[model samples]
Structures are given as C-alpha cells and as structure tokens.
Target: MTDKSETAQPSGLPYAMSAYLIWGFVPVYFKLLSHVSPVAVVAQRVLWSIPLLLVIMAFRKQLGEYAAIFRHKAHLRNLLASATLVAINWLIYIWAVSTDHILAASLGYYLNPLVNVLLGRLFLGERLRPLQMVAVAVAAIGVAILIGDALDTLWVSISLALSFGLYGLIRKITPVGSVPGLATETTLLAPLALGAVLYFAQVGGGGFGDDVTTSGLLILAGAVTAIPLLMFATAARRMSYTSLGFVQYTAPSIAFLLGVFVYGEPLSTTKLACFILIWASIAIFCADAIKSYRASKA
Candidate 1:
C-alpha cells in the first residue's frame, strides 16, 4: 500500500515542483500545435517520447529494469493499464488546449488532488480527517455548481482528474523505478504510435515535417512528454501520495492564470464561482494536511 502520511519528502519537493511547473505551462506547447489534430499530436508525443526515454534509460543503466517490467506479468499488466489511462489523459488535455477549453482543463487539474485523496481512501485504506471531509464536500459542491451551469466542459475537467489520479495511483503501486517504468510504458505504446503516424502520413493529416518550426516542435514532444513524467514518478515514490497531490496545485494554478490572462479563455461567472469554492476547498485540504503531518510528528 502507499504511505498514508501527508508529509512530503524533502527530496521529492524538487521533482514535484519541476513536474508540475512543466505541466502547468504545457498548454502553451500544445496550443502552438493547435493546427494539428489532437490524435496526431498525441501520436507524435508517443513516437517522439520513445527514443528520448530509451536514451535516458541507457544513461541511467535502467534498460535492464525497463525490460524486466515486461517479463513480470503482474507489473506489466499494471503498467499497461497506467499507460492507457495516461494516454487518455494526454489526448483529452491536448484536445482541450487545441479547442480553447484551457480553463476547463485547468479546472480538471485543480480537482485532481482531491481525486487522489479519494482514491487513496478507497484503495490505499487512508483515513480522512474532519477537515479533509469538509474539503471533499466543498470541492464536490463546486463541481456540482459547474455541472449545473457549465455542463459542456465538466467532462473535460472530470476526465482529466480521474484518468490522471488513477495513473498516479498505479505508478505508486507498480514497484518500478521512474525512468524504467515510463520507458516501459512508452515502449508499450510505441506500436500504436507508429500506426497512428503512418495513418496520418497516408491521410496527409499530421503536422510533422510540415515546416522547420512545426517539425521541430513535434520532435520536441518527446522531451516534453518524458521529462516531467519521469520527475513526477520520482516524486510519487519519495513522498506520500496525498502530499504529492497537493504539490500538483502549482501546475493548475499556473495554467488557470494562463487561461484567464494569457490564453484569454472566457471564464463565465459560474466557472469563476466554482474556482473560488475549489480554492477554498484546497485551503481547507492543505490545512488538514498540515495538521495531520504535525500530529504524526508529535
């Protein structure tokens, strides 16, 4: 089972921050490819990520470990599931960004930590505190308001939360190192990625090799996808899941600000209200986490 403590490891903090910061700004990267189809962008992400991940594995000398995951059926199964969830999450996120639904995408990530909390309670046998309970309730109310008023975009937020929350949970339990696990996941995904690339080429539908700028950006997708994921996996292994979840706030916070100001996505009054309530809930959740950590220390 994953650790129940809310105390983040000092070592994990850097990795968590690095991962979330990149994620927060990733919408910008995807937005640059807005002319590309979401499926093609994700396919490029998978195909390009493979070699970068492999090189990292070679440098880390974790190639043996990466291969070992496939030999271990149980671990392989878990990684396959995780790969699927993360792929879904990536596809949805890119689609949302390309479609100018970044505000909704930001909201989804804002709710992700809470989803992690609930997943921890249900699957990892973590107990919730009074404040944590209140936090959950408030977040739910905020979502309810979103559902009532902005039903169209609610799916984007909710899907991102559930898929990513599940992916993190699986990675935490998979008993594989960060670089190896992600390498393995990308490897598992490569065949379909290859197929997608071929299909896009045949259909003349993809952005790759279209120009110096577009092709270069598409190639960089590998690094963009792998680096933060490796960092996140490292952080997840070092810290408590809930603490890691809280650290996730940084990404969405940045993304939310970008959505409103940089991206200029419209924020309806209802969405603004939901953001306020969700922020309040996050404050409550952080307080509860601090209290629990202190109590544990005592």
Candidate 2:
C-alpha cells in the first residue's frame, strides 16, 4: 500500500486554502483574548484541544493506532520535545499579538519557510539550491535590518521562527500521523496546562471564569487552534510539498495586514524595508521551488 499523502489531488486545494485563511485570521481571535494572560490563553488552548482531538481520533477510528505509536519510547521522547517547542511557539505568538508586536510575529512567519529550508539542509542533508541560498541570505539581512530599530521586540520574531522551525523539524523526522502526534503532545502538556490554570487562579489572573464571554472564548480556543492544524495536515496529504509551500505565506500576509491596517500598529520605514527584503527573498525562493517541482515532474 502506498501513502495517500504522497499523491496530489485537486480536492486538497480547498483544505489548504481553508487552513491558511484560518491561521491568517487567527490573530483576530487571539486579539479578542487580549485581556487574558498569554499563559492562561495557551493553557486553555491545550486543555480544550485534548477533548476535541480525542473525539476526532475516535470518530476516525484511529484511537488504536494513536495508542500504538506511544509504545515506541523513541516516538514518545521526540514528541515530548515537539510538545515543548509548540507550547513555546504558542506563548510567544500570543504575547506578541497582545503587546502590539504582530508585525514581528508576521515577520517570524514570513521567515519560517526559509528557516525550514535551512533546517532541511542542516539536519536532513538536503542541498540548498542557488536561489534558496540567496533567499536565506536575503531573509537574514531582512532580520539584520531590524536589530537596531526593533531590537526590543526582535527576540519575539527570532524566537517564533526558531521555535516553530525546530518544531517542524522534529515532527518531520518523527513518523506519526499529524492528529495522533498532536493528541499525544497535548496529553503530555496537560499537566503543565493544569498547573498554569491553578497558578493563575491562585494569583487571580485566570481569566476563564471572569465573565461569560471570556469563559466561552477560552473554551472555544480548542476549535480555533486545532481545526486549521488538522486541515493543514489533511491538505498536506493530497498536495505536493512544493505546491503546499506556495500557499504557506497566506497566514502571515493576512496577519501583517491586520497588524498595520486593522489594529493600527505602526509600521516604521526600517521595518518596511525588512518586509520588502523578506518578500523579495520569498519570490526568489518560490521561483526555485516552482522550477524544482517542475523538474521532478518532468
């Protein structure tokens, strides 16, 4: 039997688009929870996601398979690391949005694919194409441009990029289905999440029960967080990696617009220059991906 994910199917287009769009607009949802502590928000996300994902696994009758993956101690170990990385990514992203560093967050994501490319070369022994090398260097300069003007929040961008990039690397090497892997990660983090709830409540910062709207939104964080991830995994199954890569920019682009235009975050000339450089890098990188994909097909 062959892996379905290795083949391209037109139907995957909708799933890919839907996933990226939701991810793009997700800042809006997190922004709504601005009053909540980032820790509390992430805790709610992890706890709520457990139940929903378990239900999804059960509905798909993957419960047994999910359980079997854990029997491998190696898988368990890698998943623990992946879980930690994802949790870190979630916290930084929320903090960035609430503190008006959405542009930094946006830039982090804009640089993510490039980060992945570099990681692939570094860890997976993949060779970087000429354009890809240029893309990476260009993105680095874009990041370098921010060291002076945006030094204060530059950590947010780099942390987000590195953490998520590493998380993807771990997941790519770990042989498991996306949903199962995610369910396991949440399970591992459940204890930490519960501690966050208890600690926050003790300090009177847990915002879940503060009001009806807040509580409801916290509960729904599961949906907002898990759905797009699941959709993306599904889409990845039916699309070529290169094709999927082409659409990966949608989320950051949307978030960038929301940061500047919708939420009125100021964009400085220096930051604008960085974005332009990153965009140019993406163009070059994407052109390379297109050519490589076509060559493989030929």
Local error of candidate 1 at 47, Å? 1.1
List ranges where model 1 is wrong by over 4 Å: 1-10
Stretch of 10 with least lDDT, candidate 2: 1-10
Question: lDDT per model, in order?
Answer: 0.89, 0.84
What are the TM-scores, per candidate, against the unseen true structure?
0.95, 0.92
Please write out the lDDT profile of model 1 over residues 30-137, one tens digit for every residue.
989999988888899998898888887788677787877778999999999999999999999999999999989999999999999999999988787789889999
lDDT of 1 at 10: 46
Clashing pairs in 1: none
Worst 10 residues of 1 by lDDT: 1-10
Cα lDDT over the full model 2: 0.84
Error in Å for residue 189 of model 2 = 0.2
